[model samples]
Target: MASNRPAPEAPFIPAQRETETFGYGDHRTDEGPWEEWNPTEDSVRPVRGRHRVAKQRGGLARSSTVLGVGVIAAVGAGGMASAHTGKPPVSLSMPDLPSVGSLFDDSSASDAARATTPTLSKVGVTSADSDRSGNAGEALRNRIMAQAEQQQSKADSKATAAALADAEKQSAAAAAKAQKEAAAKAAAAKEKAEAAAKKKAEEERLAALAKEYKLPVVSYTITGTFGQPGSMWSSGYHTGLDFAAPTGTLIKAIHSGTITQAGWAGAYGYRTVLTLDDGTELWFCHQSSIGVSVGQKVSTGDVIGRVGATGNVTGPHLHLEVHPNGQATGIDPAPWLRDKGLNP
Candidate 1:
């Protein structure tokens, strides 16, 4: 059997037509006015204002747009990148201030801060470990200084201890010296006491020996004491007993004695000395005149002198002194006078 089918339509329409038109002032031409005539379906194509072209990607144009987009994306990513690797975006945030600017001008503060300014580290640069290390260094320095001071203090304490020890030694020595001195003083005082006791015993023996003698001067009133302190005599104290009596009074011999010294002495004026047979001497002083002469043989009851105020005499008085032998010292006449039955 036969089929009346022309050849099948091709995959693409082969016929293509391009037309151009000119317009002026609202005038137009229609399809009936033929400038050139040819009739063929193959030659004419449907007039195309809107055509459904086969949508195919353009390689050059698509590549160009892709490169441009790639450039723009790269720029945007670069602008939004983080300042630090782990930080937020740099371009998306405000910039931070420099840390050193915080304390750049410290002179605006007080003097205490200024004194410590050199020790301060730059702002934001110091780490915790660095601060700790700095503190440790300071502590070490302080410890060194403190140790030095301790050593010095120990040395000073030792010196002071030595001084105190020396002082104690000196004090001990002084105490020993004082103790020795006190012992010496006690011994001296004991010796003095013994001497005074011996002298008192000797005086008692002499008083017993004087019991046999009689008083030489008679009818006399004792005016001055034997040891009265006065300047009338050369010595400060009176050397003999004073007897107040009338002038031209009969002077008697104390014992049977010979006249030994009879002269005008200075303080004891017109003195007469009589030596007894027992080697005792008696001085009769401040006489008006002496009846005896030196080496004159006289006995008891013989007149030796008259009582009067002679040379260096404050009154009419006789200074009588008894001496054992020709010695210069005179004994206390009161006891001897008492043995003679007279109170002086």
Candidate 2:
């Protein structure tokens, strides 16, 4: 098919140089005809490398081939530097090299070489795994600390509870002890008060009893005592006390009693017998005149008769006798009368 685009030109191929030349200026070949040097515009092609413009028709082809070979060599050297080092090509400083600017200007080739090279990270840098491990260790440490705190708190609470319980127990015991002491003290005081009151009541009763009792006689002269040896009675002794007094002298009863007999006896004269509440009898013999009748009640110091020589007496005198339980025998009335707060 017919197209509008231009056809590609053919590549130039160079023939080998037969002999080598080593001089700077032009020289003649060994067999070709001599040609004169010309400086006219039409004769001189641009001098490049080892090739020259020839007069024959194929001269352009030979020079083009040499140029192509030089270009291919430069491109290969630039590619190798870029591929191995991933940088600009080595340039001429002390050693000769291609220009660094020209090599770096190929941005697309530099990028391709960089992509093919193995990538590396900086040395001695941190990573995600190490960070995670550090975080886990810190968390574990915090958990351990928290658990220790909880255990310490529990121990403190137990100690406090035990101390409180002991305090309460001690307080209760102290309270009970105080109460018991108070009760004991109160009981002792009450007992002491009762004893004092009982003693006071006894004193009052004894004082009242002392006020009620009296002596038997006021003023009496004892002439003869009981159990005295005298020739005054048939028993050959004085059986009773003799109160010597004038005739018609008032004679009083010894104590409160009932008059059981008040009449004349056989041997002498009138006699009066008084019986007390406890069955004791008092005989007032030798009374001249009897003032009380039989079956009469009399008090202490009441007039019962008058003193007279009525019984077997020497003169006008009163003979007093006492009998316990109204028996025939008699005791001395002196001590009996003194027992009731009397000295006589």
Best by TM-score: 2
What TM-score number comes out for model 1?
A: 0.37
Clashing pairs in 2: none
Q: Provide the TM-score for each candidate, comma-separated.
A: 0.37, 0.39
In the order shown, the candidates' Cα RMSDs to the true structure are 26.9, 27.1
User: What overall lDDT goes with each candidate model?
Assistant: 0.64, 0.65
Residue-level lDDT of model 2, residues 180-248, one tens digit each, is 999999999999999999878866765554454444334567888888996657888878777777788
State the lDDT at 294 in candidate 2. Answer: 88
Q: Give the CA lDDT, 0 to 100, for residue 241 in model 2.
A: 74
Clashing pairs in 1: none
